[model samples]
Target: MRFPWGPGDVADLPTVGAGVDTLSDLSRSAEPPGVRLRTARAQARAFRAEFALTGTPDTVVTCDLVTLPYPTRFGLFRASRAIAPFLSITNRMLVIRWRDSDGRPRVLLFEPSDVELGRYTPYFDNLARKTPGVLERRMVREHGTVLGHLARLGIRPDDVDYLMFDHLHTQDLRRWLGTTAHQDDLDARPRAAFPRAKVVVQRDELAGMAELHPLQRPWYQPDTYRDVPPEAFLPIDGSIVLGPGVAVVKTPGHVFGNQSLVVNTSTGIWVSSENVIAAEALTPEHSRLPGIAKWARGWQQEVVLNANTIETTADQYNSAVLEKTLADRSQADPRFLQFFPSSELTGAWTNPGTTPTFSHGHITHGVQPV
Candidate 1:
C-alpha cells in the first residue's frame, strides 16, 4: 500500500475533488459568514452522502497517549463562565488498519507522537512555571507509548505506512523523523520511530514550522525540526483519501494547516479533530453543561470551537459545521454526533464544572491481527 508520491509530493495521492475544495473556498471567501456556513453544511451533506460510502477499515483503536489539564475557557470556547479554570483531558492516538482501493493492507498512525513534549510550548510552559500543583499532580501518563501499543498489537516500527497529526501543535518531530544534525535538546541521539513511514501533513503546516507568526509561535516546537531532513514529510493540500474508510480533510481556523480525520466504522462515520472538545459541542442544544447552551442560544451559534488559538474564527466555526454534517449520529446517545475530539475532555473530580455531557471514551472496531 505504498504511496507513489515521494516526500513533499502529493501528485499521486487520491483527492476528494471539488467537494473538499468548495468547502475550503467558501470558508475563505468574502461571502457572508452565515451564507457560507449554510452552504458548507449543504456541501458536506452532499459530500458524505455521495463520497463517504467507502468500506469500513479492518480495525480502528484509540490509544491513550497522555492526560493533562487544559484551560477550561479554551476547551469550551470561553462561552462558559464556569468556576473551573482547567479541564482534564486525554490526548489519544489512532491506530487504523485498512485496505486501499487496490485491496492492499495499510497501517496508519494518526496523532501518535510527541505529546509529552507539550510542556515546552509557551502556554503550557508558563502554566507549569506558575501553577502550584500542575507539574506534580495534573500532568500524568497512565497509558503506554505508541510504540508499546504497536508492539503489544504485534506491529513493528517499520510496519507503519504513514503518520500524521491533526495539526502541528506541541509536536517535536526529531524523535519521530530523526535529525540529520545532532540536537542537544533531545535526551538521546534522535532516530526515526517509524523508519519507513512518511509524515502525511498539510503543506501549510509544514511551511509554518519554519516561519511561524507571533500567535503561532507558542504552539509549535520548530527547533525540533531544525535538523530534520525535508524528505521526512509528505505534504498535501486540501483533502485526500488515504485508503478505504479513511480520509484527511482541511478544517482550518484552529491553526493555519489544521485537518480532521474522517473514517467509516461498523457503526457509522466519525470525524476527529481538536476543533470541538466535547461531542455536545456539535449539538449544544442538548447539552446540560452550565453556560454552554445558554451561550450558544444567546449568540445564536450552533458550533463551539476549541479556541486555544483562533487564527480564523469564522473558518473554525464553519469547519465544525462541516464535521457535524459529515459524521453520523451516535448510536449510544442519538443526541450526540460521532465527532471525537483528538484531545477530549474527561471527567475529573479535581477539575470541577468541566465534566462533559457526553464523552465517547474511545473507538474500537474489529480484531487486530495476532
Candidate 2:
C-alpha cells in the first residue's frame, strides 16, 4: 500500500531505521532533560540491565498489546464499542530508559491504555463506563506476558528507578481509585501492582491538574509530584529541561501538558515519551483523516492545561497538516506503530523474531539480541 506519507517526500528529515547504526548519531546528540548523575556506575549497570531486558536500549518503549475490540458510542457522539458495527481495542504503555557513559541507569514511563471504539452501532450507555472492563482484561493478559518474559531474562522489579506518569487519564484514575478502595478485592487486584520505583510527574502538570479539576485533587498522592528544584528546570523556547540530562518539550495538540522526554542514553539522544501524536504520526510520510485530526486536537485541549501555549505550535501545525492529507484514507491505510522507548522493549520475548531494534537515522540493520 502507498502510504500517504513516505520516503522522498521529506528527504531532508531523518528516517528511523532499524538496529544500532541508525541510532548511533541520534543517540550521541545532547542528552534528554531531567537526568543528572549522583552515582554513575550503579546507574549504568541498572540501565544496561533494563535495556537488555526491555530490548529498546535507545528508543521509546510502549507497553500493552494492540487488538480488536467490540464497538459502541458514548457521550458527545463519540463512537464507543457498543455503537460499532465491529470494534477493536489496543492498549500499551510508553517506556523510556537510559545508561550513562559509565553504565548508570535512568528511566521514564508513560501511560498508553485506551479503549478504542469502532464500527458504529450506537450503544446507549457511556462507552467510558464499559472501557474499564475491556482495559482490565487486556492489562491482566499483557502484564502476565510481560512479567513472565522479564523473569526469564533475569530482570527483577527492583531494578527500575523511575516511573513517569505521562498524564492521569480517566481510565488511569479509575484503576487507581478502584485499587485504593478495594485493596483486597480480587477484581481490584491490579491496583496494588504499580512498579516499586520513584513515581514522577511534572510539577506544573500536577499543579495544573489540580486547578483544572478540583475533585481529582484527592486522587493523587501528596508525594507523587516532585518539583525539579529551580536549578533542575531548563527553560528553552519550545522545551523545558527538567534536570541535567532530562528535558520535557511541549508537544501539544494531543493533550494539555502533552510533553516529550529527551534523554541521553549510552547510544545517543533518545526522544522518548512523545505525546503529541502516535509513532506513525511522526513519520514524514503518514497522514491522518481530517475528522480524526480535529477530534484528537480537541481532545488534547479538553484533557490537558495551557493547551494553546507556544511550545506546541509547531507540533499542532504539523499534526493538522498530516491529518488533512490523509482525510480520505482508511485507518488501515497507515501502518501505525505506537511510540515506545528502550525500556518497555523488555516484554518482547514472546515474539523474538518480530522484536524491534534501535538505531539513528542512517542504520537499517536488525537489533542485537539482549
Candidate 3:
C-alpha cells in the first residue's frame, strides 16, 4: 500500500509542510493576554468532538512495540519501597500506524528514547557516581539502543512519522527530533533520529522544561532539546485526535503537564502513560479505586505515583481514576485492561517477556493483520 507521506522508503516522508505549517506557529500559551486563546479553544472543541464520538476506529490501527532496556528503581513503580529495591525496565516505544483524517497512511511513535546517548543517560550518570559500577553492569546486560530495537522490528530511524513522549524525563529529543540549524556535523553532537517527524508535546510540558523546578530537575535532561527550533514542535493544550483511533489526552499526575495516548486497538481502547506502572495496580471498584490508590483517597489518592510525583499528588490520584475509566474492561479472568505502561518497568516484575519483547500485535499489521 502507498502512503501520502510519499512513495518509496521512509526517507521520502514529507516534512510538516506549508499547508500544515501553521500548526508549528500556533501558540498554546496561557498568559495574561492569551493571544492564542481562540486557537486553543478550537483545539479543545476538537478534542470534545472526538471524545463524544466514542466508537471503534474508522480503520484497523496497529501498534508495533519495542522495549529498549533501562534500569529502574523498584521504589518507583509501587508504593512499597521495602520489597524489591531495583528492577530492570526497558524504555518502551510504540510505533502506531493507521489511516489519518486525510485517508493516508500515518505513523505515531510514543516515548522515543536512546538512553545510550550522553544527554539521555544522565540518570545513569548519576547512578554511576552514587552507586558506582551500576550503569556498567546494566549496560553489559542491556539489549540495544532505541534505534537498534526498532531496526530489529523492521523500523528504521527515518520510519517514524510523529514523535511523542508521555513526559520528557531523562529524554534527549534532539537525538530523535534532529538538531536544527547546526552546520558542523563534526561538533560530536547527535542529530534528529526522525527528521521527517514533528514532535507532539503539551504546551505547558515544553514550557516547564525550559526552566525546570529543582524538585523534578533530577530526571530532566534539558540539554537534549534546549536548542531545538520552535518550528519542529506541534504543541497542543488538552486532548485532540491525532488520527482516526489515536488521541493524546491531558492526564497530568506524573508531572504537571503529563499526557497519555489513547488508541482503539483490536483488543480495545489502549492508553499509554507513565501515571501508573501496571494495569493490575489500578484495581478498580464500583466507581472507586482500590489497593494503594484508596490510601491516597482523602488526599484523593487513586494510584501510586510513578516517579516525578511533583506537586500533583491529588492531581495524580484523579488522573489515575480517569485513566482507569478509559481502560478496556472486556476481560474478567485477570482482566486485560488495555492499559500499557510507557516504561518497561512493569515488564520487570509483572511479565518478563514484555521487557524487551512484544506484548501484542505486529508492526506491519496489528491484531487483525490480513
Ranking according to TM-score, highest score first: 1, 3, 2
- Give a tens-digit lDDT track for model 2, residues 19-41: 12111111112543212111222
Better-scoring candidate (TM-score), 2 or 3:
3
**Which window of 10 residues has the lowest lDDT sum in candidate 1?**
1-10
Residue 116, candidate 1: Cα error in Å is 2.9
Each model's TM-score?
Answer: 0.91, 0.41, 0.69
- The per-model lDDT (C-alpha) reads 0.80, 0.32, 0.54
Scored by TM-score, the top model is 1
In order of listing, the candidates' clash counts read 0, 65, 4
Candidate 1 TM-score to native: 0.91
Whichever of 1 and 2 has more lDDT, that candidate is 1
Enumerate residue pairs that collide in model 3: 176-193, 178-192, 296-301, 297-300
lDDT of 3 by residue, 1-370 (tens): 1111211222322223112121212223334323443443454344434454544444333332333234333323334322334544444667676765567766677776655554335555666566536644543344455676566556666766788888877776665665555524227455766777888776677667666677776787765554555566776665667766677777665777788877765556677787766554455221122223334444443455566445455455555555666666534333435567775343444223223222322212264323
Question: Of models 1 and 3, which has the larger TM-score?
Answer: 1
